[model samples]
Target chain A: MSEFWSDYTVRVVVFGSALIGAVSGALGCYAYLRRQSLIGDVVAHSSLLGIVSAFWGAFLLTGSGNKSLWVIIPGAIVAGLAALLLTRAVTGLTRIKEDAGLGVMLAIFFGTGMMLLRWLQRAQPPIPGRSSLDGYLFGMSAAMTSQDLWMIGLIGAAAVITMLLFWSRLKILTFDPEYAAGLGLPVRRLELLLLCLMVIGIVVGLQIAGVVLMISLLVAPAAAARQWTHHLGKMVGLASTIGAICAAGGALLSAVFSHLPTGPVIVALVTLAFVASVLCSPSRGLLFRRRFVVD
Target chain B: MDIAIETQQLTVAYGAQPALWNVNVEIPSLGITGIIGPNGAGKSTLLKAILGNVPRLSGHVTLHRTDEAGSAAIGYVPQRSAVDWDFPTTVFDLVMMGTYGRLRWFQRPGKREREQTRQALQQVHMEEFADRQIGELSGGQQQRVFLARAFVQRASIYLMDEPFAGVDAKTENMLIEILHQLRDEGNTIVLVHHDLTTVKDYFDHVVLLNRKLVACGTTPQTFTAENIELAYGVAGKQLLSRIS
Candidate 1:
């Protein structure tokens, strides 16, 4: 057990997962409240394209496959933001609703990302970091370094600070956007910022839970937290804590076990938490709700 | 003869269809004005257009507020259906949103704001339900909570969309009494009102719409059966005849 503390990779992976989990879980409440939970999933899936693009861009720029955190983080952010922008533009300008638009964009971006990753794998010259590309799909927490931890910490801090600064306006905007506008608040800008924050949340955790399962870390904790609290502040706080615990617990389990995958482990723990919250919550739980129906 | 708000050649459309077409009217200062129209007659559209919630295809809504120097402080009570009632928030927190507009972009609601929110809840008789989650409230209580949200804001003009819909008689009377009190407190209140029988009792001025201005004047003078018929088509005759 002492060896677990000494292994640098394990420490990095566990801490990184906890940081990413807390940030995404906190920010995920906005998407959940706005009834746009799918957008977070879409943004996370769309980030795969950004991850591949960063590899390509880095390989072309320096004549070597620079699959570092610096190159990848910005690439993921741009792609996530692009996906959100395209969805917004399509929904705004055309008769296509947001659901249809997001689905189409998700397919296009994810398909392209999958193809690019294959191409990198089959490259004749053998891309230097091409072997590590698949780690982003299911998240290779074992491969995480102190540098990756630093990047996650920086982005997570940015997200938490921005959330604190715009807390009230965001609450109003999430609960009632029309009312926000009627009060002469800049509704469009605040909404755009909210989506941008979602992108930040997704981007920070892209490598920890990977593109495919990272969304669960955002969603499950929030859904669980909602069943337990009626206040927005408490919900967000509880969600963040739940996310951190699930992720850290998953990291510990994967570390102790020989063959377990980190991302799916974290996601599974969060899902279990969600189910427990649904069944056992004191006030809004399924069990409690049925009992109070006669009154 | 003071006009608090005036719309000139206002036109709005959703997709190919026009919701409001070439609407022109003046809302008088410091009185309760009822914007009366049949279902889909653009009554709600007019308020949204005036508040700039939706895009105006073309036209101008000019606000004439002598009290405030900058943009007029406008409080809005959108239809109950406008917001998600099951949202995770308490009555107090929702009402606290009303004071958010008065602060700077990044400023949080302080102690004074909380005091004002409590007062607003007290005024609406929702002070006791401050901690209750919004979804737990009845329809009438929800309406009252919405009213409290709007009332927390100190604005010169209040635009309410169907504050009387789906509410019981006791709640309706309380809302009317509150509206009259707000008008008496020197604020211009405009409502997109239904219920033809109560038009005379509730509103002092009336603006009837049928995708265009049918007639707008004093309730006693212009809220006649003919104007009601002009906007509501054949259904007006049966409804108004019963009331008269």
Candidate 2:
């Protein structure tokens, strides 16, 4: 408890978490628009397998417990992309509902990951110098170093630039893909680019926010922001701001008070923001619920 | 004198089910063309195929130039139910989206685009409701907003699907008036119409269809009882009997 309050680590944790949130928030807008909100949930859960696989792969190849962030980053991203492609293929080939497709993909991947993780745990003795990777499961911003913060910040900035470049086409495709294609927009290419972006955001955020809570970061803020505005640009901006605020606030609070899992704390903060939006947002919000009801 | 849209043996299918059969049709460059048919008779499918929103099984759609002046642009307005109305956007914002194709990628909507959106809204008489959330609009208003969107496209050819469904008589008349104005301006307009009574009154050309093209020409020539019966099926026959 004393160690938590006495450090400058709080600043790193909060700043890093906020950046993670902003990235997810921006990407989540597209996910929600494509009517693929639940797909985010599936992707988030599936990344645990990616992380575990990356961990074991690193362990086997390097025999180095110090952990190579470079190796894990690419490994995790590739694995996550594979899972996404598999999900899309299953949905296209079978009569399975999307929800069922997501469920099946999540279960199979996560199960294999758990098996690999257990095998790794039993086969290799604990490295005396290296800390356990369990911190990633729930996220501990206190354990994150400057390198982790740099990774999050760099990825977040890249995502923002991509969004700015293709905002118009992305908005059109998200709103009405059929209409967009009719207008001769590159609908297929744009969608594929968007999917690639989502995978990148999820893979990066999984490090600091953890997969379990990353979906909330991606979806909750955007959904909440939706209640506040009618413009897509404004919604994306507001959602990113709300997500960043929640992430920063959650990380700050958790740092100030020890024994808090940064992931769930950030999610709770985001949930609070969602409730506030529902209660207070101006046009068409849930709080204005009384106005729309007519006899 | 020119053909606006000329399809040579146009055919469209959905999976294994055929929605539209090989159909050759030539359309005039101006005036309202009422496309009437029974359910699953490829009324909407024909428009989708023309718009390239749906895949064409086989055919070529050639947009001819009027005396080498250059071909006209094609615009489409899908059914109101085809999209989620609750999507986060203002009526003005949605209408402005019609100009995306004309604007460059990085550039935002400028004053010119905004003015076009406003004028389009005014055309539909929805100028007062420009700032309204799309979900807040009634079915009729929503349909008008979409019409306004297509109007902003400002293309020479317009293809609309079920613009009259769920609309009030006033809204319907408003739409008809706009269509008339566009026709008078020499823009070709094709409407997927449900009502048979208004074909002769509302449009100059008519396409009667049931899975395949039954008849296509001027209202007097193609809207005959025999063609209407074939287009509408038994229900159309019963209705024709009642009308007579």
lDDT against the true structure, per candidate, is 0.88, 0.78
Candidate 2 residues A1-295, lDDT tens each? 4575466677677777788778888888888777776777677777777777767666666776543445456666776667778977887777776678788887887677667666666664774223456655666667667777777677678877988898878887888877776666778889888887777667666666676667778888888998888778888889889988988888887777777878888888889989988888776566676666311
Candidate 2 lDDT for residue B45 = 84
Could you give the CAPRI-style class of model 2? medium
Quality of model 1 by C-alpha lDDT: 0.88
What local lDDT score does residue A201 receive in model 1, on the 0 to 100 scale? Answer: 80
The model with the greatest TM-score is 1
lDDT by residue for model 1 over B1-244, one digit each (tens)? 8999999999999877899999999999968999998889899999998888878889999989733536565788989898887788998999999988888867998999999999999999989999988888877888888888888888788899998999999999999999899999988999998888999988889999989899998999898888888888999999898898
Best by lDDT: 1
Interface RMSD, in order shown: 2.2, 3.0
Every model's TM-score: 0.97, 0.90
Summarize candidate 2's per-residue lDDT along B41-64 as a digit string, tens digits: 999988877766677879987766
lDDT of 2: 0.78
Candidate 1: TM of chain A?
0.96
